[model samples]
Target: MGNFDIKDFKGVIPAVLTVFDKNENIDEVGMRQLISYLIEKGVDGLYLTGSTGEGFIMDSEERKRVVEIVIDEASGRVPIVVHVGAIGTKISIDLAKHAEAVGADGISSVPPFYWKFNENQIVKYYEDIANSCNLPMIVYNVPLAGLLGMNVIKRLASIDNVKGIKYTGMSHYEITQIKDEIGKDFLVYSGCDEMAMSGLLAGADGIIGSFYNIMPELFINIYNAISEKDIEKAQRLQRQAVEIILYSLKVPSFYAGMKAVLRWRGINAGYCRRPFENLTEEEEKEFKEGYKRIKETYKITGVEFLDEL
Candidate 1:
């Protein structure tokens, strides 16, 4: 905690999609390309090895390797927060220590799930990992791992290095409550994609979402619009994003649909690994057509240049 300010974690960070090859191995070159692309498009930071990065599916070594590759390529251009949440407490600690060793700016983790862990057990789990490294902790309330209650959230936030949270649920009132009841300096990032405008208005310091990997500019526009007090403009852009997200949800998997969109955007973001469906030939075609409908249907803005599909 020497000079680390949790405020650096704010703004439009992508839950960054992990790039993989046809065989679903980590593709280092593709990963570097995607990092540069997002940074060039004005992303504030990168959250690696979370759901979008497919960390839960990868083994410990694989997760550590992904963090290493991203840190080396990013070269400190933006703050990198690695997700260290895993099924085992010791494994999460190991990953957290590795992230600290490789110079990641911060560490985050979803709560351990798949079984019952009492409140104290949960608190100790986070406490152990937070004490493992000097890097600040961003508690990820990403329900894929498990849900974190408000009482547990406050307890965790009270930890020495625990500074913020990635609130993936869709409740702004809760965001407000976290700030008002917890420290006002506490950083809470809205993890839900569709609620960008509302979340910001509700006092979310920043936004981190899976969809940001593909349409970062649109979300950035929403952030700027909020800053400029242009509610009308922000609402319009948020609607466009919601449109895209809803359409992506219709695909075999929203994450896979995002990869397809990334390829369409000229980035070679590969498919999600096994157990997650990659788009079929027919699905890909339908995804493209639905994308075209979005473009025609809305006065969309802030997306970088793209060729017609």
Candidate 2:
């Protein structure tokens, strides 16, 4: 079994968005550049093929290819948590095994989607996948999954090799109860960017968010401040980060807005995949102005300058 465990999974891990060309093909070069850029920005880890990464829209081969590309680019510098959740049991297991084969640090998965899975069914599903790989598993309790409930989280957390839950639905207090009931060894991560500080205050070890892909330095500062017991600084940064998040929600697609920001910075990550809308010209213009506002209002350039060093 791999020595990889949950202890190594803490900190700001972005649910990275997959970069696509105009034809909706994966831009491998752009992806590699983005990975390097994020690593340079001091992000602790990457969560591949999650909702932000548009995992469900991709086929199995595409998902595996994305994971492989991310792993190859990352080169063990940051822990890579591959999200292998799928509708079928065999597919999920196969993705989990593929993640292990490709040298991912860990695996995270949403419960069976589309159907309302019972607690035992969900537990058995995760148990089977975890047993198939040496990588520690994180249960992603996504609100959109339609199957995850309080009972599901508690049951899944009890499974062997299931070391964490990415808490996205409901309130932090609900997650806190699960942590209290299950014991602290079960790592909890805030799945939403806007709720990161609140989740951390409620005992979340860290966050797995989409916006962190665009503004990692801000999140990292917030995390570091909290870790240093500087609650005041953490709160201030959190407020600033949330302001950017709120504006992003008004754009066409949140991931597209983030990709546009990267392109503005010369990253050239391309656009969001199809069916998922891209930013219109108007939104693009607003995004630039909004981004400028975030930087100036939150003093993000100063934060990023230090991050460069």
Which candidate wins on lDDT? 1
Cα lDDT, model 2, residue 269: 75
Best by TM-score: 1
Residue-level lDDT of model 2, residues 1-309, one tens digit each, is 223455888899889888889899888999899999999998888889999988998899999998889888888788888999998889999999998888888898888878777777888889999988888899888778863777767778777889888989657887688779988888888887887888888899878899888788889988898889999988888887777788778876888888887887778778888888998888787667766666666665544422332
For candidate 2, the clash count comes to: 0
Candidate 1 runs further than 4 Å off: 1-4, 305-308
Give the 10-residue window scoring lowest on summed lDDT in candidate 2: 300-309
Q: Count the backbone clashes (under 3 Å) in each candidate.
A: 0, 0
TM-score of each: 0.96, 0.92
Model 2 ranges with Cα > 4 A deviation: 1-4, 293-309
lDDT of each: 0.87, 0.83
TM match of model 2 to true structure: 0.92
